[model samples]
Target: MNKKEYLEKLESELGQMSYKDVKDIMDDIGEHFDEGVAHGKTEEDIAAGLGSPEELAKSFREGGTVASVLQKKQAPVQNARQKDTTASAIFVILFNLFVAIPLWIAIVCAIFTVGAIEIGLIAGLVGLVLAIPGFGNFLAAGICLAITIALAVVFVAVLIILVTKYFVIGTGKYISWNKKIWKEGL
Candidate 1:
């Protein structure tokens, strides 16, 4: 089948998944098809080499989360810490397993809380435009309100960037922890 047909079949197979997730998967595979075509391979050739989308989708479903898919895609860092024989290094890995999750939850919660507070501050500023005396000029108030809203949007965008950065850092750290815990036992 053609690229479109193959992806459609895959999407149908992954019917229960989020549309965003399916689109991301299709985008990744589509890039592979593009690369193959660049090298003079046909869509059918690419699809055949990749195997049936149904089976692929089934494997992904069995894997559970998007994080698993992501971890599968990214390669391991070459200079991954050696099986350090130090005492604190081992302690840190074990301590992190239980501790880091709560830390991540707290970070996520803090980001949410900060975003909420910023938006609430914007709302309060808008209210102040009506409540305050000299600052109540309609045109000025409208402009200030728009500026405040824009700032809030920027704040959220920054939060998204920060959270994504945290996710990447956390994923690498977890991989290191897994290696230390499973590969090099105490």
Candidate 2:
């Protein structure tokens, strides 16, 4: 049979084997066929030399079982440590993305709050200058200035809170915790 037909037969017979494992074994068998062809063996001769697919699959399963057992025995301690490190790393990354990024964004928004106030102040000053001869104009400018100053103060406060929470609390505590976990694992 051709390679495709042979692979299909193997897949049907190997009930629990992964497709990748079956494919790898098929590749090895294909290589043997190629070698036989190079040595002037006919397709029939090559087919006769290669064992049955069912038998080959049993061998593959046996090998897989032995390998799995060996793998578990060889690295139980390392595997436990690797699992801990992986969990810690994931926590650190998630904390940075959710907590740190949002905190930093809040701080940036706070800084921009001052800029918004400055813009408002400039606008108010322009209005004041235009209203030079009118009491109404002065009153309007004063209101604008008050509103701007309030916004600036609120923004400054928000920025301070965000910076303190991220740098002083979240980062300081979690980063050190992550480092300690990594060192202990190593």
**Whole-model Cα lDDT per candidate?**
0.77, 0.70
Q: Model 2 misses residue 46 by how many Å? A: 83
| Model 1 lDDT on a 0 to 1 scale | 0.77
The weakest ten consecutive residues by lDDT in model 2 span 128-137
Candidate 2: residue 72 lDDT (0-100): 84
Candidate 1 global TM-score? 0.35
TM-score of each: 0.35, 0.32
Prediction 2 TM-score vs. true = 0.32
Candidate 2 local accuracy as lDDT? 0.70
Candidate 1 lDDT at 48 equals 97
lDDT by residue (142-184, candidate 1, tens digit) is 7676677767767776876788788779878876866666555
